[model samples]
Target: MAKNNEFLWRRLHSLLGIIPVGLFLTQHLIVNHFATKGVDAFNEAAHFMESLPFRYALEIFVIFLPLMFHAFYGIYIAFTAKNNTQRFSTFRNWMFVAQRITGIFLVIFIAWHVYETRWQVAIGADKADFNMMADILGNPWMFGFYVAGVLAATFHLANGIWSFLVSWGITQSAASQRVATYVTLGIFVALSVVGIRALLAFVV
Candidate 1:
């Protein structure tokens, strides 16, 4: 019974990471990518999202709750899960270790990000605009930190998609898994470019 419950929880965690969480991450990067266009472009995109109907309700139910569950459960898994890299160093094995590492890092990165941006906006301490981002990334250290954070986020999502496919039985054969690996790598590169470009836009 305990194993069964764990299996269910793991399944739900994988599903949530892909559905709303992955989708949201992609959308957020795209929105930020508008920064590359210009200040007004980014602000317009950001404001449009902020003005969505039932925004707060959607945020709490769709984004925050699922994210909290995934983040906390992922931390538990990260600390408890064993890796086979020591005995059998393989591509997937390394990826498994990397996934846990990135997951842990993301927890910290996301928390700081939300506090720096969302919490400030909520408390009227800052505006969620291009200017605000520009100021934050104005510091060289912060710029470097954000670059690392963006890379970590993209890698996590891309690799998570590969795992999601195999665990969900979407790609069971070795050949299919190989294909997924390439596809997910492409996703990582593409997202990293988008994210970093947005960050650079702020400092520029």
Candidate 2:
């Protein structure tokens, strides 16, 4: 019973990780494309989400749960794997590292993002206001960090799509997995470029 429960929970975690957790990040990026419009845009997007069905409750489901599982399991996998402290032992080893490094990054980046966009603005503690997006983007450090984070996010999502597909038994063949990987990579690149450009434009 205990073994079955752990196995079941892990599977459930993977499934939830695939849903709005994985799906939502891509969607979230697209929505945040409006960030180029500045604070009003970001606020409008956030507000729109709040208006959605059982917004708070849904957030608990979408935002908290899967995120916790993915992050926890991810850390567990990372540390337990031989490559955690050693070199990329093999292809599978590198794959795990790729996912884990991005996962770790996302943990920090997302927290900072929430602080900057959600709490800061909500509390009216932000200094940039809506129109100053250009200045924020123009800053060398901020722009650099933002671009890196965007790319990392894109990579994370792309890799996650592969993880989700294989876990779901959607494609078992190597050829199919390779094709899916390429397709996801292409999509992430396109979205990241568009999102980054939009943000840069908005800031200017």
Candidate 3:
């Protein structure tokens, strides 16, 4: 029963990544890309998001709750799992370790990002506009942090997608898994380009 429960939680964890969390990341990048069009475009995008029906509720269910479950359960898995990367020393093994490392960084980055942008705006402490984003990203350290954070996030999501495929029994064979690997790699590269471009829109 204990083993079955663990398996169930693991399956849920993988499923949650692709459903709301992964889909949200893609949507977020698209919205943020509006910054490239200028401040007005970016602000309009922000406004549109805020104008959605039951905005707070949507955020709580679609974003925050899923994120909390994914993040905390991920941490639990990281802590409990036996990492034998040292003995294995293979590409896949390294990526397994990297996944956990990136997850930790992502948790930190996402928390800080949400606090700085969402919570601040919610409390009337800051405006959700291009200038506000530019001001934050214009700083050298902050810019670097954003770059690193986005890279980590994209990689984690990309790898998680591949893992999700396997976990769901969608890619069982070696040939299919290899194809999934290449596809996920492509996703990482594409998302990294979009994410970094959006960040640069703030910097430049």
Candidate 3 residue-wise lDDT at 42: 94
Ranked by TM-score, the better of candidates 2 and 3 is: 3
TM-score of 2: 0.79
Stretches off by above 4 angstroms in model 3 are 1-4
Residue range 19-124, candidate 2, lDDT tens digits: 7676777777777677766667776775687579886677777887777777777667666755543654765567668877887887777777767766676688
Question: In model 1, which residue pairs have backbone atoms overlapping below 3 Å?
Answer: none
Ranking by lDDT: 1, 3, 2
As for TM-score, the candidate ahead, 1 or 2, is 1
Give a tens-digit lDDT track for model 1, residues 74-159: 99999998787999899888999999999999999899999999999999999999999999999999898889899998999999
What is the overall TM-score of model 1 with all chains considered together? 0.96
Q: Cα deviation in Å at residue 199, candidate 2? A: 2.5
Give the best candidate by lDDT. Answer: 1
lDDT of 3 by residue, 77-163 (tens): 888878998799988888899899999999999999999999999899998889899999988999999999999989999999999
Per-residue lDDT, model 2, residue 23, is 77
